[model samples]
Target: MTAETSEPPAFLPGLELSRILYEEGVRPVLDAAHPGLAYAAARVGSGSEVLGFDTARSADHEWGPRLNLFLADADAAALGPAIRELLAERLPKHVRGWPTHFRSDAGNELDPVSGHMTATDGPVDHRVSVDGIGSWLRRQVGSPTAELGPLDWLAVPQQRLLEATAGAVFHDGPGTLTAARARLARYPDEVWRHLLACQWQRISQEEAFVGRCAEVGDDLGSAVVAARLVRDLMRLCLLIDRGYAPYGKWLGTAFARLPVAGRLTPVLRGALAATTYPDRESRLCEAYETVAALQNATGLTEPVDPSCRPYHSRPFRVLHADRFARALAATVTESALRDRPLTGSVDQWVDNTDHLTSSRLEVPE
Candidate 1:
């Protein structure tokens, strides 16, 4: 009989599809032909599922009934084809109401996935596995001999990195899956420290420049600074937990749940909502101080500036300013608590038009 014989239910929640496949499709193959076929796992890696943001519309092709099969090289070579053929023969051609042969509705002419799979429009966009334990480690963190360089912190898009590293590993044999998961669990302490440091440095460099931005008649530029502050601050919280920050859409959701979340939310919301350039600058500076205090409280870094000095100054002032800003962001738990020390200086917030050109950072069209 053709695999298309039975019509299936509507798309199960992405989380449920794996079990549905295992009990029906994958296990049957092992029961019949390859007793040593070894293992199957439903790792919803990459894209929305990994980030826990998947919705109903994500149930298009490349989205559901996905599985990654792992075996000893010999078993894989033997069982892979058998599993495929069996699935082709016995698995329902449609899961839920979705078609197994669904194609791209994406307007562009991108190539569709080349395997037989049903759709749920979920966030899992790919399925894969390493040959064994060693390969899994290398894939997760790079080999010692051919180590992956530390990411170019500034250039990496937060969402892509989140997807690359997100998701759960469903199964493993001989500890290969466990080992890969341990390695993927979190960034090393130093790496998190460095990224947090770099992000804060970026924010501090722009913090007091809001008034200058508005002086050039670009209130929007000032708002961009506020937005970046929010992004970097959210990144800081993720660093505190040793987690990589996901894309911005989920950034706030993640932030609101942090242990220090209660205090941070108001400060962040106030900073984001401040309409006047001066008010925004004050709130931002206060936010920096609050974070600095939290850093000190947490023992994350050495004390630099208890005062939270203005950003406009010479080498020493700039140096201390960046130092405290970095320390606070990495260690602070409650954002509002850290921002208690609001600044009194307004002069540093003003901008000169000469430095406000729109073309210095422009790229070719």
Candidate 2:
């Protein structure tokens, strides 16, 4: 049997698969076995559903009928393992033709019985993990609680935050998980401005380099700079739209959802694809002006003219992004935030997955 639907036999999206598991496989058992047990159920973390980018191919591993059930700390400790054991015997063998038990690897060998995906009646290490919300948050992000400070916000990876808050919650018994997610929906207004300022600062630092490199006959270097500018510009758009920018895999996908994406997508693509130095420069200048116009429309700061001018003492035409950065910084009322270095958030500067995912990251004071 396959996980086919009336619509088609195509791979089920992670969200749909998760919902089926919750409604058909988990909910009924919980109601019968542990009725009135307060818990939260959701499908989040590292799945395409969390990012809403899953395809049929995503079902190959770590996919299918999986969920997280968050209970009180004590209740979880006492009942979590038993619930897992019960669900292992009770859940349907194939949820929409997808196995509830994932195959596991043991000691350099694929154990069919212990595989991450296996049939029921076997020793099933299920994916329906049970834990307290605090433990869950602590594992997903550093802070177990939601009262995150500026440093905490800066240190937590945007991708992780996005995952933590993105997917659908099937149930929240005490509303704890929902409230925590609300707190992380976005940065505070002041922090948003600070990040925006730093993003602009980044663009300003490098906008001139694109032309400087080209002038030195380093067309390759010029192209590289242009690509970086395009990335920063896309990120800036996300900030302006008050959206969290995911990592590279979904950067473009997330960017496309922004209101400005339709106008800026072609320009950004042209900037990256341009081969000649002059062509690259021209495309980048256009992109910069477009984003500058977007910045002005927000009215977050004193509107600067959305046009390119020649870099001082140089023939290169460029957008003076520092002007925008300074304008945004001026709107920040917090002296402490304004005084901090404009390095932006962790995702802004760090690219390594291991570093971003580490909860022990130290945020600069």
Best model number under lDDT = 2
Q: Candidate 1, 28: how far from true, in Å?
A: 3.2
The whole-model lDDT of each prediction reads 0.51, 0.82
Predicted candidate 2 versus true structure: per-residue lDDT over 254-301, tens digit per residue = 999888888889988998889887788888888888889988998888
Candidate 1 per-residue lDDT, tens place, 207-324, comes to 6556567667788888887877766676666666666665445778777767767877788888789887776766766666666665556566875665555445521111234665
Model 1 residue runs over 4 Å out of place are 1-12, 72-82, 94-101, 104-165, 303-307, 312-321, 325-365
Candidate closest to the true structure, highest TM-score:
2
What TM-score should be assigned to candidate 1? 0.67
> What's the lDDT for candidate 2?
0.82
